[model samples]
Target: MELTKGANAALDAGDVEITVSWRATAGSADLGPSLDVCALRLGADGKVREDADLVFFNAPSSPDGSVRHIGRTPDGAGEVVTVDTTRQPADVASIVVTATIDVVTPHLTFGGLAVSARVADLATGAELARFTPPPLGPEKALVVVELYRRGGSWKIRAVGQGYASGLAGLATDYGVDVSADEDVSAPAAPLAPTAPAAPTAAVPAAAAASAADLPSTGDPRVDMRKRLDLRKKTVQAVLTKQGIPGRQARVALALDASGSMRALYRAGTVARVVERVAAVAATMDDDGTLEVWSYATEPVALPPLRVDFLADWIPLYVRMRKATTGQGGADATLARERAARAAGWPIPNWDAIGGQNEEPKVMALILEHYERLPSPPPTLVLVLTDGGLYRDKQIAELLRRTAKLPIFWQFVGIGRARYGILEKLDTLAGRVVDNAGFFAVDDLDAIDDETLYQRILGEFPAWLRAARAAGIPL
Candidate 1:
């Protein structure tokens, strides 16, 4: 049935999926479309069930298992949030769903946003109802719809309510800690939408007491997907500009697991990088799984991480604090075991390898894997680190040779450490092609996925053409 403003309907469907979609053109030049799905649990009085019951991006799901916020759609196309009617907590008498303007134009109001929402039954996937709110009054936020328990039945209401105060005001109505992001900037960029707290040594304490307080709308995978989609044309355009056609390729990640980088791992920067890489791999690789390795001395191939398992990737390994550091070096054996339990994703076991910040081994393994494939696919390797690698000359020599292989290296500098050789790689001479590139960010958390992925991929197309012209096997 069509839903009009302030109209309500009894939703007899047992389990339902609600998707919100909109077509918005910003009135301000600096403004971008940044909207969010917030699920507010309410008690009998209809205020709020409790502070912890507020579900959005950071806290993706309600603890009671009733609500699940699937990642956002790209460029404000839309979003999906699921509700299992029977699973809602006993105390949650109502679930108020709101769409809020996160950080767009200062004057953006719900009335200006052409928005619509639809509810569908999960089991049969049948459309239960849909509502397209007209130009709302002057509110930055809108109470689009609400599902509540009424006389032993479930019902959906098209409230068309708008919040003048936007998300901040809506959040304040709930009990989320409304303060500042506490991320102890690593002498780096201000990482927002990710975390709070200073660089502490202990993982558990920081993640619990401070890090979780930071506001975040999307996870690493969702962030990466949106970026890749937005920049698909740009990436294609560049390749065309250089007369370089793109290819389907495998993706890998080389992580720096050294002592100095301990604080970053604890801070969850590395994990976020991995998830984004996995998302990129899903787009590039034949399979969505990515080869993950750690090197301080030598490279240890860890379990290949699939995008599906990325959510649990960090939380699962939080106990393995400093796992990549020189303290234990690299151990694919342990990483593989953990990955094996990833609920049956097609992840390969990592090979056990150990050494001290040895970058060459990572190069060797990536090349070897490509060599072994019946007909190798082109490959891109993302090297995540806070500083430069050892064996500089050997790595340079290796890159010179691999310039003839179907492999390209992108090094991301995570902290303010002098990248002795990495900074100079673009101009280094005597290669079949320029196969290596480098960019630095004080913190990955602060960088938007679009900006980060674009830069990460910027020079790759040129290198691909060079490698192809050099007669590297396709």
Candidate 2:
């Protein structure tokens, strides 16, 4: 259905890509007048699930392949905030499309710019709707249009609502806590390993082993049934500090799989971190399942992980990392990797996942899959990195954009490489709440589980309170 300014239409839209695009006139050539498209995914109550649902240039897509903003070159014009209605998850009741005057641009408003937008089907490139509202009074951003659910049918609303205070105000209405300044803290000194633990007698790297040779579940839980009274003692002791009792949330790990992380992987440091995270899973997760993902050239999800198999996982993983090429693919070796514990050999997906770290793509892939969930859980993605983050502006924008979500991002740097960008994450501009935190540890093993858990949990409580208060679905 075609829509005029302020008109609402019952749309025949479904599972189609709705591309929102806009460009302003040149009266303000000297001043920045870029058009930014954003998608605000509403929950069942016609409200947002959390900031995670808001996808834009910063966070380009959701975890699931559902909603994504394939638009690039914000000001260059063309399609922006493309929506895949078919991929849109059920919990996301409405997809609000917005176009705002670039926030970073100074002294620019709708009144000074000539802007027009079109919503077209991506496949056909057919214009479904268009809007050219009258000159604005004082607003700097416009809720250009809304695609929502009505009577079991998707409908469209030409919202045309303007936020005089600009993106920040629109963000506030959408549950973003923009009032809070970006949270910043001095980067902690990196943890240093004292001395390598005494080595066991050297054995041929090619030796064979079997699954029976592996250890039992290290978790104190009775086979991962419940989260009550069963976490590891040290994990439980650490969590008892009580700023808040743990609540069920989706937990995920983004382990750096770059070549630089080779040493850590070989040393079994990755396995140890997994164990510590399992202890955390025993607390905050319902079924004790942890979503595991690792990134090198790009991001890839791994099978759900439990604490039991995590033992000797890295060593087994390293064993497959032969000087030869075909030696990879850990999934193929899971049976062997498991048998390799007794028989020691198969590593399938592990060989294909890591390389160069693309932090932006890493986050985009995670957010995409999360949005695909039937009901996205309040998420916590622990990113363990061995070095610096090159795409600062991109990652900074993502953290700022998703700050309203019931998700907290923690970055743990393990190597000597300076985490210069991550250290100042809290100071990035345009953020709602401090959605991300960063800390550096020179050695992964040097930090105790309690200390690791403590550092990870630090800003979590405040984020919970802020997100809930902002009306974001937790």
Candidate 3:
């Protein structure tokens, strides 16, 4: 169906690919505008919930994996965004397909380009709708079309909305943190490791035997099965399935305490995560204790938690604790400082270490902590975050350094915010052995234990063999 501006068409239940094509105007400048096609997954509020909701060149796929920018068309005339309505999150009400010109010259606009977009059923390869926007004026960006939820079904609309401001302006209107775009760079090739490549293929049974059967370090009275909660037991099973059964490792938990994570903390989701990861410690750690830290601008070392003390851990450390401060001036500051020190807390005036994302600082601290130990065990650091990671280069360097050590960083993205560097760990290079893995879950409370465990340990076992082969102590 050829759709005019404002026209609509019903969509079937399946993956629909939106292709946007643009060409330079006749007899224009030799250099054409750098056209970038993007898809914005909007919520019921008509705005994106987070920066991850916008799928573009930088962020190729949505966190839910429903919306994906499939790159330039086969002929290289346009870009395609595949919308899997079948997997679309309930909160996503619509996906707006937009096209923008990377302005290299002053006052560049859509008038200099001829742009059109089409939607087709990905399965059958049948064109469902096509839209040719009217001639635009000074707008540098245009919302060519939209695939939106209609009751139980889906529908497509040709929304020829123009934006005089460029991609940043248009994105800002949709609730994306455009400020992050400035610090963000296009996904680059991962750094090459200086060391020799370790055996990455699944290790033979005999080779894995030496590293198997971790010593039982916990109390002899408490049964292992009885110690772990159901969810943690599932984690243990997953570890076994991944070929690292009964392997001992020091476990650490790093929780995000940024402003954006306030909701998760308030809903007791963060506490639940602590409970779950503590199980990993129970199963793997020497002392059956989990080292804990909460971070935003800085990392706050909290009291270490054990399976037995988990019941009281959340209420005391995980839960937010507010204390009076500015109202009483110097006396208040002195009082709070003394009180915080007496309680063994890190800082005097603390708000869960809540502020902006300074991942490198906390990461450095974690690295230093383990480095100080005489002989640290193979450590599994589970960094739970809700996205907003911008220090990509620093993080890459740190991971590279960590590759030579016995530490494995398993970064779990808690929500659908832009994960930036964490989302691109697979492509990261310059490591003796790949020491990091990442996966995002939309809702922690809703995910089944089996699937969560599987994802958590997906790359760990392989890393274990590889690490040992590289002569890293485990």
TM-score of each: 0.46, 0.48, 0.48
* Highest lDDT model number: 3
Question: Across residues 292-348, which tens digit of lDDT does each residue of candidate 3 receive?
Answer: 877788788766665543543444456333332122233444454454344333442
317-428: candidate 1 lDDT, tens digit per residue: 3222334521123464245434434323233222233324667777787678777878777788888878746578887888887777778899889878777788889788
Each prediction's Cα lDDT score?
Answer: 0.64, 0.62, 0.72
lDDT by residue (437-471, candidate 2, tens digit) is 88888876777555777888777777777788777
Superior candidate under lDDT, 1 versus 2:
1
TM-score sort, best first: 3, 2, 1
Least well predicted 10-residue stretch by lDDT in candidate 1: 184-193
Off by over 4 Å in 2: 1-231, 312-351
Q: List candidate 3 stretches off by more than 4 Å.
A: 1-227, 320-349, 352-354
